[model samples]
Target: MKITVLGVGGMGSRFALMLHQGGNDVTLVDGWQANIDAIRKDGIQANFNGKPVSAKMPIYSPAEIDQSGVKADLIVVFLKSNQLDAMFKRVQPIIHKDTYVLCLLNGIGHEDVLSKYVAKDHLLLGITMWTAGMTGPGHVELSGDGEVELENFEPAGEAFAKQVVSVFEGAGLNPKYSHDVKYSIWRKACVNGTLNCLCALLDCNIGEFGKTKQAPELLHTIIDEFAAVADKEGVNLDTEEVYNHVAATFTSDIAGHYPSMHQDLVQNHRLTEIEFIDGAVARKGEQYGIATPYCKLLTQMVHVKEQLVGAK
Candidate 1:
């Protein structure tokens, strides 16, 4: 399959490498010039399962492809939410009628924004529990063993969803077709609501946070509030069960890893997804007449930190 991976950051780079290794023709795209230059000079480096390896693939900046017309069967977007608008604008020339666009970003509201730009038939919603990060320029580290779930939007169906899953699964990544990707996204968001923000606020790794005396209680509050909001939105999720499932993963397999929110704060980059995760809960709480004091407070604190750091 001809695939183009847009936003070749941590997860994007890892996906690019996996696809290439599986013998798919893959092209990597990112906005950063240094990372692009590094990948062009040396191969894309991925540290998976504690081993370092490189995948040789063509890397391009958006500018390089702007003048040359190019398209792909599939374009997998791994950008942060803030970058979506610019990515969609730049990829306009290459998006064809049949080009399938799959977004694997965190948080909600992505599908709404994407629908404005692309046809519903061409859009695929997806979520991943796999944890990865960019260790340095041109280097990506893979940390977790969760699968990827994807489903077609209103105009697409199960067959289209299966094709997308098959491509990723063939590349050795666990991929599943979901009839209800909305619930999958919410489930993943529930996990992130507890782990990501808490880890960022406490300045600790997943295991350290789990072991902290206040960790479990704080996590429970966040999960319970989020579950209430999810219920209000008609997405039924068992808060306690999800909490246990996430806690087990954090304590065992992903003990040493820092959540992406923590990494963003440490790097002094702007953290906007907090608005979607905790802020989303807080918003829903207001509508449903539920008080989300904790979520609202954390949302404010993270915003203040972002302003202090001058992140956009």
Candidate 2:
């Protein structure tokens, strides 16, 4: 398959390398000139399990993508939500009419924004439990297992979802087609809401947060409020199940790893997805006439921290 990865940062670079290694025609696109130049000079440097590996493929900036004049069968986007608008605009010209655009971003509301430019049938929503980070430009470090759940929107069918899953599975990432992707996305949000914020606020990794006394209590509060919001939204989410999942993730193979949110704050980048996880729950809680004081407070605290750090 001819694949193009837009926003080739951490996860995007990882996916691009995997697909290329699987023998697919892969091209990596990013806005950063240093990353593009580095990959073009050398190769994509991927550190997995503390061992370094490299994959040679075409890497280009958005401008270069425009100059190439090549179309892709599939385009996987892994950009921050704030960059979505401009990124889509830049890539629109290169995307073919039949290209399947899969979004592997965190949070909700991305599908709606993507649909405005692409056909709904060509859109796929995805969620991942894998943890990764960009160690440097054109370099990515994989911290744990990569598992993805994907599904198509209203105009797509199961066959399309399976085709998308096959591409990821071929690349060694365990990808599955889910009939209820909405619930899966919500579940991921539940987990992210409980842990990511706590990690950012406490400046700790998953295992370290689990070891703290206040971590579990705060997590319980966040999950409880989030579950209430999900229930009101008619999304089936069990608090106990969600809590157990969050707890297990800390002890899982990815234990001791810091979440992307924490990494963002440490790198002095603005954390926007907090608005999608905790802020989303709090907003829905108000609409459902449920109290979400804890969630709201945490969201405000994170915002304050961002303010102090001058994060964009």
What lDDT does each candidate get? 0.81, 0.81
CA error at residue 4 for candidate 1, angstroms: 1.7
Per-residue alpha-carbon lDDT of candidate 1 for residues 1-312, written as tens digits (9 for 90 to 100): 888999887788888888898889898888888888889989888788889899778877887787655778888988877788877887777778778888888877688778877788888999987778887789889866868888888755557668878888889889988878888788888777778877777778888888878877887888788888888877888877877877786558779988888877755374557877888889889999998998899888888878887776
Please, what's the RMSD in Å of model 2?
A: 1.7
lDDT per residue for candidate 2 within 62-111, as digits (tens), equals 76667887688888888877788788888877787888888888876788
Q: Poorest 10 consecutive residues of model 2 by lDDT?
A: 264-273
**What local lDDT score does residue 57 receive in model 2, on the 0 to 100 scale?**
84
Worst 10 residues of 1 by lDDT: 263-272
lDDT (0-100) at residue 135 of candidate 1?
79
- Please report how far candidate 1 places residue 121 from its true position, in Å: 2.0
